[model samples]
Target: MTAREVTKADKAEPGSPEWLKLVTASKIPSILGISRFKSQFALWHEMAGNVPSEPISESRQDDFDYGHAVELAAAEYWRYKNDGWVISRGEVQYTDDALEFGNAATIDGRASRGAWRRIVEIKTARDLEEWGDDGSGEVPADYAAQVIWQQLITGWHEPANIVLWPQYGKPKIYSIEYDAQIAASILTLVREWNASLASGIPPELDDSITTYETVRRLHPEIDGREVQLDAALAHDYLTAVTDDKEITKRLRGLKTRVLDAMGNAQTAVVVDLKIATRSPARGDAIALRSNTKADPATIEGISA
Candidate 1:
């Protein structure tokens, strides 16, 4: 196997771990549809070397590794089909050693049939229902963006996104063509993000929950470190909190009234809609046997 040269995007501080470094592929999602995110580009800036990034959780990493392995197996299965000018399992380079041009992409497979050439991206999905089979062969937006990114970098005229849905009979393959305008716009957005990182000034945060969580994580409350807000800000905050409390009280009252009125009826009819008041039936859990052996270590911990 030929050694892949590391690009500037893949490089990190001499002693820094790989997770802290921003990967080129991670930025592709931001360019999927819009050129904006909840945390502006601050999260991505952190990802791309501006600041440290949170390491992926072990369980999530395990899922990723498993998915990758499945994808690779699928890629290897079709690698032998490049009969003519088609190069199967081609090594796609995002950038040369100088890292002047191109971004990174690992195309699952590349194949050609006569005058046609395509870059194949294999995906393992939990279910096939995510794909549309109404003769449109529609794929989710993020996956579409990724294939388009591959097309942009690999220069593949048409990129094919093959989804392996195990429950389904065969794999669903969607061949996608490039939009020159979209490509140009995405490149511009990438440059904008790069500029934001270089300037050390992040863009405004969005109203996403992830952004809120990230903000909390970045600046947790320090004990006895309270600052008074101005009248206008205080008014807005109090108004929001008070309104939320009133609305929640009203909702709880309505729900309690409905539950009290429900009596023996499992379902309640509100005009034309049916609201279920009954809980779902659950299976009985297994009972522990008294005959089971107990460990002395468990007793010591229980006592503590």
Candidate 2:
């Protein structure tokens, strides 16, 4: 149940350029979040060609419904650009000789207006404001890295990102110029990723609860079973528990300090940030904001 696409190159050979492109180019950029801790699993999956079928979750369905609209937005952008200069759009695979991986890339479209020549990546985001600086041409860090790989493949240093909002009629265009050093750093990280896969070693988990969730999903806890950890690992786990207790105490102290500072005040101003106290029953709690569209699972009346 791999999402890997079939191509005419598959009939030719395994290590052929087309085969390389098939593996690299057709990758959906949204899933390739290099910044995410779980992304290492994607790299591992690619190297091993062992992609487990991801269940069609609600979020995934929403993404699919919006994906085509983004493509159409890209197509329209190309149409407007073509009115001014020469640009090409098609399914093309590019391989870079300089990169260590030298993986192929299949770009959505290529465009040039005046002296500016760049590859275009189309996207649809539910929230557009998070991209940052409004007009400073800031894209998500993961997307920046993804486009950098595309640039490496296309032998193009510049990329124009067209991100459309489902609620808005106009698209926000980001003209990005990636630094070669940054791209090199990302490439090094990717090489290490592949090497880890080759060695059958999983990357160290970072601060992502999603990675933990993924592990739990794949292998649920077994009751009445004891798996032994190495001596050092077991010691580390014990140390972590001790540290967690200390951290919890310190966090409580910090919270108390903040609450005391706001004492009986409905609104507390912390420089540019606003901290508001909300009354729920007999207690007052800090007004919190959630990043997701849904209510917090920890909050009352909200379920997972």
The global C-alpha lDDT for each of the candidates, from Candidate 1 onward, is 0.55, 0.55
Cα lDDT of candidate 1 equals 0.55
Query: What tens-digit string does per-residue lDDT give for candidate 2 at 1-304?
Result: 1122225463424334334223253342423454533455543443454444345689778776677556766667656755775455443456555555436665566667777767777766543445642333467666666777777666666655544443444666666686788666666666665576568786555456655554555566588888888999899989999999999999678767766776767544434333434233325544422223223333544332
Clashing residue pairs, backbone N/CA/C < 3 A, model 2: none
Candidate 1: where is the Cα deviation over 4 Å? 1-23, 31-39, 48-51, 76-93, 96-102, 112-117, 127-137, 164-170, 220-223, 230-304
- Per-residue CA lDDT of model 1 for 87-141, tens digit only, reads 4543344432323333466655656677675777666654333464222446766
Error of 2 at 142 (Å): 0.9
Give the distance in Å from residue 1's predicted Cα in candidate 2 to where it truly belongs: 35
Clashing pairs in 1: 22-47, 38-206
Regions more than 4 Å wrong, model 2: 1-37, 41-46, 49-53, 78-83, 86-93, 97-102, 112-117, 133-137, 164-166, 217-224, 228-304
